[model samples]
Target: MSTDRKPDIALHFAPRTRSFVALWLLEELGVPYTLESFDLRGGRPTTPEFRALNPLGKVPLVVDHGRPISETGAIALYLGDLYGAPEAVPAADDPDRPAYLRWMFFVGNVMEPSFCQKMFGWEVAPSTAGWGSYARMFEVLTSAVDGDGWLLGERFTLADVILGNYVRFGLQFGMLDADPRLERYAARVTARPSFARAMAIEERESARFPPAAA
Candidate 1:
């Protein structure tokens, strides 16, 4: 449901949150937008004004078309289909469309929660749990990467934006082991100019709100 007129896009963002994922996707879309960067450490999100946009008071909320869009996966899909350049979003009839959507959901649904489960040593049966087990999740992700590289074979779509960022974070935090193929895929996709742009923005914002003293 894209509007005919391009609405002003404002990213209500903060560093050290899921906000970076949206920033990377927006840069990859190559669209002109403004960053409403704020410091979560400063207690801005708890204000009534911010809570009006998201009751949960979260960052990385995108206000486009005069409406706020929360959740990283939703924001990526909306922006990808609406303004993504070089056809980063697949056509409705494309065979890879189903798989493309699946990967987008996988990042938030399976990847994040499973990583938390592994990190915390949560006890949950693979058969009953929605994400199964961390091992299975990792295996599934590994199998998704094909010989041609990228999730969708030859095309690099928004799926890469979502999945690539998560893998990059996993590698950085040592949550994931040294899987050569995953490492290569993360390097390849994130090496894009768009990712560089996102990183630059992230660096500037982080400096403004430096990590707390140890």
Candidate 2:
């Protein structure tokens, strides 16, 4: 959504964190913006002003024309709607919207929490837990994400940005059980120029804030 006036957008991001999702999204948006990159240890996110924008005190927050957008799914949807057209996001009434929204929410709602459940070795009844059990979560993933390649087939949407990045990270860090199709999918996601650009900026910021000597 281009305008005669360019939007004053800035991302309050921290390197080597979930902020990469927002960074990649911004790159995909192809809009001019500033990266308010900083290290988390600086106590910036915990500040009152920051918390006012996002009560969670998190990175990956986008200040778009003075309106703050937090949460990965919300960020993806908001930015996608603002800048995405003809591609990136499916139109509201489009047939793909339902599934697009499903997978988009699936990331933060099911996938990430399931990983946490795995990490903590927590056991909860399938019906009790919000993630509906880790194994069950994976089952749903295994079924939806197969041979078709893109979750929505030929269309790559914001859902791919959210879930695809998790799958890519899982593949990279050995966090996910081996699934050949997901492996191929991660390869496809990483191959995107937007992903590459985001990684490059991450590298530069990472070095710029290299860990302090012990």
Candidate 3:
């Protein structure tokens, strides 16, 4: 039994969703925290107890100092700042800030929405759709990963933390095919000890919750 202080940051997780992103971020930060796994399909997150934390009933929510924060992007950015790894996340004044911020937002704003749309059999008109289309989004993503091991070149930054998870999710869900670049990148990110540990936790928790009805 470990006796670390009740972490000021607690993550509400559900396996195989955006929770993995937060899990990876927490692992990367090497922070001491608690993970409260919710079975979303079982309404574990919607119960009166959890509803007080998030009325929307979403997983991947975080409580920091008793204040609730929802959405994966927000949680990732917050963790990056709190952990303060300049290598993992560049400072605002850093010359790489623009590219770094662009890719970070791209995962949430572009990739995720586009992924959901395509996964659900919805089609968006290119003229009005913010992501243009799923095809275009993949093209953009592949192009970004074309050059190097990391998104912003040799240094692995928070943008990698964001996009790396997306790539892994896309591959696991079959939303993405094996692009050599993405395949290589995914392997590199998951090969990290922290990511491997997070994956182990996710797998164990997933077994605890059976799948929803067909």
Best by lDDT: 1
RMSD of each predicted structure: 1.6, 1.9, 4.0
Candidate 2 local lDDT, 59-87, one digit each (tens): 88999899999999998887787677556
Q: All models: lDDT?
A: 0.85, 0.84, 0.82
Rank candidates, TM-score, best first.
1, 2, 3
After best superposition, candidate 2 residue 149: deviation in angstroms? 2.6
Cα TM-score per model: 0.94, 0.93, 0.89
In model 2, how large is the Cα lDDT of residue 39?
91
- For model 3, the superposed segments whose C-alpha errors exceed 4 Å read 1-7, 212-214
Q: After best superposition, candidate 3 residue 178: deviation in angstroms? A: 2.8
Q: Which residue pairs clash in candidate 1?
A: none
